[model samples]
Target: MSDWGPVFVAVVLFILLTPGLLVQIPGKGRFIEFGNFQTSGASILVHSIIYFALMCIFLLAIGIHMYIGSYFFLNATVTPLASSSKSSENHFRQALLTFSNSKPTNTSFLSLTQIGKETTPSDRRGCCGVVFVEKWLLQRQDWRGQKMADWAPVLIGVVLFVLLQPGLLFQLPGHNRQLEFGSMKTNGKAIAIHTLIFFAIYAILILALHVHIYTG
Candidate 1:
């Protein structure tokens, strides 16, 4: 099977397993009440940001792993050569020539060519072919920036949550009391739990991204 098959499957599974991404909007009976029983938009917005950020992280990890696994499978199935030593040597030389002569303008395009040319029998057959194999592997481009892009949403969400905390607190029905930074009235427990939740979600997102990118 091609690498894309497993990648597609993983992506679908990840999406299916994560439904919180779709639960951002307010629903019936899911309202946050402030003083005088008024609904708080700020509270809803803060919570939404937190949830969305977490969702982005989860998806990112899934993508990273999928790509990594796919690369492994492709590498394992590739055979260098099966003919006589001389013939294998000649083929390897030809394959190397083909790879060297081809100048890829972009990373993705170059990777496709490298994968196609290096996995063939001529270039990959014997134990001594390890160096060639490693060279081919190294030719693939890094997608770390892409992974970071996937994680950006989650980071933004965390920032938004922190910045809107004051408004969020005001929206709470019983938490209207404000405490000084050094005051004993501060609800450290609430703050801590909220921070922990965001971190946990971010971790999951990162894991998912790793899985997806690698497998793909």
Candidate 2:
């Protein structure tokens, strides 16, 4: 299969997974809450189950779409590519290029950092290829004016995961209080691990289905 489809899906998933991107860091100025409709632990557990179930259904749909839309079903069994790395690299390069060419709306918070700094465009591409090795792998992207620590993305992921869990909701000292939903607070490790596992499983399932569909 081509890289674009996988790249597109990865980007979509990233957006879906990181709803906290808009949120401000703990304390710089006014803080913004990330999510809405905070629920009890029981409600959250149920929601989690439902969320995962729907994700499975979505994966099934993707497999079916691949089989029907691609030449895989009609042709003899062919081994699927071992990974999505090439596709990911290409897309990241494209992203950097887009960031480079576009006029900056926010000079303070560009979408990509180190654009004109460290390396030339060609060298940057080479280095960035290593950095963005996988879709879920978090190398810092610009988030407002804040300089996210290396583990910041992981923390954001963890925080979001915690918020989704059953919890005694405390009114966090931020912009919003009376209404539940507070600013983003996450555990970096949890999010990183979750992303790695989720994407690994997803890639495996996709490859398996790709091979199985063609072989059968």
Per-candidate TM-scores read 0.27, 0.25
Number of backbone collisions per candidate: 40, 9
Model 1 clash tally, residue pairs:
40
| Distance from true location, Cα of 70 in model 1, Å | 21
Q: What is the Cα-based lDDT of residue 186 in candidate 1?
A: 19
Question: Quick one: best TM-score, which candidate?
Answer: 1
- Where's the lowest-lDDT run of ten residues in candidate 1? 105-114
In Å, residue 120's CA in model 2 sits off its true spot by 73
lDDT of 1 by residue, 12-51 (tens): 3322222122232232356422222222344355554545
Residue 82 error, candidate 2, Å: 47
Clash pairs for candidate 2: 41-166, 154-188, 155-186, 155-187, 155-188, 158-187, 159-185, 159-186, 159-187
